[model samples]
Target chain A: MKQNLFSPITESMYYILLSLSEPLHGYGIIKKVEEMSQGRLKLAPGTLYGALTNLENNKLIISVGVDPENIRRKLYKITDSGVDLIQIEIKRLEELLRNGKKVYYD
Target chain B: MISQHKLFFAWNEDKEMDYLQKMARKGYIFHHTNFFNYYFEEKEPESINYAADFKGFDKMPEEEYLQLFEDAGWTMVCRYGAWYYFKNMDMDALLYNDYHSVQNKYKKLLLFLLIVGLPLYYQLFIFLPRMSNEALTGFLFGFRLFVYFIVILHFSATLKIFKLYLKFSKNIHE
Candidate 1:
């Protein structure tokens, strides 16, 4: 029921939605998130699983496929809506950076 | 040797886990769990990591469900019921990073209480009015006491979980 997708995106949600731009399963997303963040983002199974549920519920992501060996490891990909979220989030963060720069750099 | 201990679902879950962890440190690696007993086998006293999570069905082929964790270097130790216990093979073995997902576990527990508790409440309501005689009244009074105790326990527990969820939401990373 969180319809306002980009109102407040947490760091974990940001990475998770970004990771799903391409199809990735549960463990795949975990590994990718760590690699994507240069070992900074350490995602837990419970958090990842719950985020996945919420993301799907909000229609930001969709199940694309499943791991061949393990059917439970369903692959996920960002939807068109999710793409819009990424763009909006990027702009919002850019504004924050610009405002910080004006005070600190000036 | 196997040791028996009581288990309470709502409040004592963390304590139950800690008790097992301490036993593991003392060279008593936890073997399996029953309703009231946690069996442990002797082993060398060394640091071992353990984590637990609650998950549900559509988790077909339990081997593969576990293999995903195994691939991530978390060896599945046991799956007694909904609780899946694992031991870390490496440092990146945290089962949960944020309290939001941890809240999901309590939600499931609350659902279970509603399912089991509602019917009992209904049955007691029907039985209470019929006990008019002194002997029956005494029996009903004692039984009602037991029922009321459980109602208080469950109510307090549910409220506690809701408060925890709210607290977690405040400073939460997700």
Candidate 2:
């Protein structure tokens, strides 16, 4: 179930990439990850920026632009590679759930 | 303006004590004024007197005073290093711990892999004869792939840790 190419990228990386599918600034990404994770993950500012930088370096995401009102902040959006990876991850997870349900129920 | 502050630890009247007093007096005369304040170690002093005319001293061509202080039997405990300006007067221990912990974690991981993985690989390939040469070759290839995978993971993790450290240090400075 976890055999997909994107499974090597960590759950944190997957979630972070998912968060940036829409353009998001640093804080916005953190809040989205937390909310989406159901508070299971609370990303510190350091962790969030680290993940963002890594994703950008890997070309999985690209910085869109800085908000005109807050130049210190930068916004980012997922790239084609990122969207592809997320799709792979979703398929992998779905497979895992399917196998688990079959094993448990049938 | 250059200012001087004197810290007195004890009230002994020995030659060492006398020497310190002489040095202090000379320092004052050389600068041509009593532009200094004395602080007793035991008491909380009011109004630290920072010498106003000490500006040029910071820009002094050489650190002559440092040698002079050493010659006067004063131990130079601390001096400015690379991060001297960014260092906090308090929370030094916390910052030091953070730096050392990150360094030690990397060191330990490297050490563990070297100590454990090398012998295990040697035993698997060289000692185990029942494992066919083709099987051994495949195992070695798989091992190399595993190592490559681990290298990528470690590289990513290291980048993340470094970014976290940079963010923390920058926050502290701000």
For model 1, how does the per-residue alpha-carbon lDDT over A1-106 read when each residue is reduced to its tens digit? 2345455677888899999888998789889999999998888866776677778878899987788876767788999999888888878879888999999997
Worst 10 residues of 2 chain B by lDDT: B48-57
C-alpha lDDT of residue B23 in model 2: 44
Candidate 1 lDDT over B57-172, as tens digits, reads 43234654575666666787777777787887453457776666676666766666666678666755766556535534566778877877877776787777667666666773
DockQ of each candidate, alpha-carbon based = 0.46, 0.01
Residues B1-174, model 2: lDDT tens digits:
234464321112133234333443344321222223422232222221111101111211223323222222222323222101111112111211233223333343344445545655565557454544665466676765665565565455445545544554443310
State candidate 2's DockQ: 0.01
Candidate 1 local Cα displacement, residue B83, angstroms: 2.5
Error of 1 at A61 (Å): 1.7
Q: TM-score of A-chain in each prediction? A: 0.90, 0.85
Candidate 1, which CAPRI tier?
acceptable
Would you give me the overall lDDT of model 2?
0.47
Q: Which stretches of candidate 1 lie over 4 Å from their true place?
A: A1-6, A69-72, B56-68, B111-115, B120-142, B172-174
